[model samples]
Target: MSDVETPETAEKEELLTEAEKKALIALRRDEAAALRRWWQRLTLTPHELEKLTKQRSLPRGVRAVLRRCDSAEAAMLTQGFRELWAMLPESTKQTDYRDEQLQVWSCIALVAAELRKEESGVSLAKRLGQQKEQTGKPLMSELRFQQLLSCRTPEEFIQRLRRALALADKKGVSVVLLASVIALWWREHRGRLSAKPTQRLGFVLANDYFAATSGYSHRKD
Candidate 1:
């Protein structure tokens, strides 16, 4: 083997890196599409929706254990969650990101189960910003929205997210978008070190929230 690197070898290595990047992007797109499809199915099937919603009312202790992802208790307590997990892309079920996927999936199922409508197209943060209280303020206060983003655990996130989802349901926000954003948020949270500066999930959501709120406030004014 030669000690010195040749230009040809360096070019080959660069091309290989680019190929890997493209492959990763494609894989993520496929996974996201699969997740959206699963959420759409849940919305269309009333019986399945009913069963999943029941998981929300399970004892707090059981719900806490459900956050463990690998627990047999979670598997036994919610067949719906298991089915949802099974429907996810095989890459998501792999050991590498399995626990994070489950944590995100559980929260999505719980928050989405609270939705009264299954509409699509709008982002969750914008929908929340657009919704108004009877007193003519944004339904989700800035303080509350900040708190939601600041949650330190899955349990806290789910609890606040369910309340937010309920308000979103009143406005008929998109269930698919809602679930997908939460999934994206979880991925960003877990991989913050590797995430691009332009792609910060919190910044994206804050933009959506504040932009909508600004427009809404102006209209109200």
Candidate 2:
């Protein structure tokens, strides 16, 4: 039994890593053109650009993909990415690009743009909640959102994420996944203020997209 358990665990871990790698590879292949264009347009340092393209910085779509990323985390990242996409200048849009793929790449660019903004560890989760309220989007209750937002650091962030995942169950709003979403949100949005990086509205909009497709639910705080 012990031997079986060890191998099973290892296999599961391996599968998880593979899933993550596949997601990143897909983003890179599909978004390569946009990534490069954004890199040049944004004047990103090579290192900065690398972080922006990191899988953790992109959106999570589909069930299999979300499982690999932790659903709650993915949700938070989606919110941030969604907000950025909505704020980007019209020049970034390409008529030839597939709509879904274009939105994904736009998130990547938005992350880089956010990182380029003024560096301050703001309450990103809170900001998302606020944006949701302002936009009149159906979000997880404000109380729950605030509870999640109370997480200040990455470690605390993950803990809250786990809770959100548990409450969300497997339906699509897993707490850890939401945490990833928030991290991805932060990854893309934390930066200097001078660049006027697009607002968090894109991430917010993305959340709307997911709510419609994924059956996501939220209540007031």
**Which is the leading candidate under TM-score?**
1
lDDT of 2: 0.35
The 10-residue segment of model 1 with minimum total lDDT is: 1-10
lDDT tens readout by residue for model 2, 185-211 = 454434312232233333433443344
RMSD of 1: 12.9
Per-model TM against the reference: 0.65, 0.28
User: Which residue runs of candidate 2 sit more than 4 Å off their true CA positions?
Assistant: 1-140, 173-183, 186-221
Candidate 1 local accuracy as lDDT? 0.56
The TM-score obtained by model 2 is 0.28
User: Candidate 2: deviation at residue 81, Å?
Assistant: 23
lDDT per residue, candidate 1, 8-108, as tens digits?
Answer: 33332332233223323212544444444444444445455344322212223332333443432343346446545665556677877666666777666
The global C-alpha lDDT for each of the candidates, from Candidate 1 onward, is 0.56, 0.35
Cα RMSD for candidate 2? 18.0
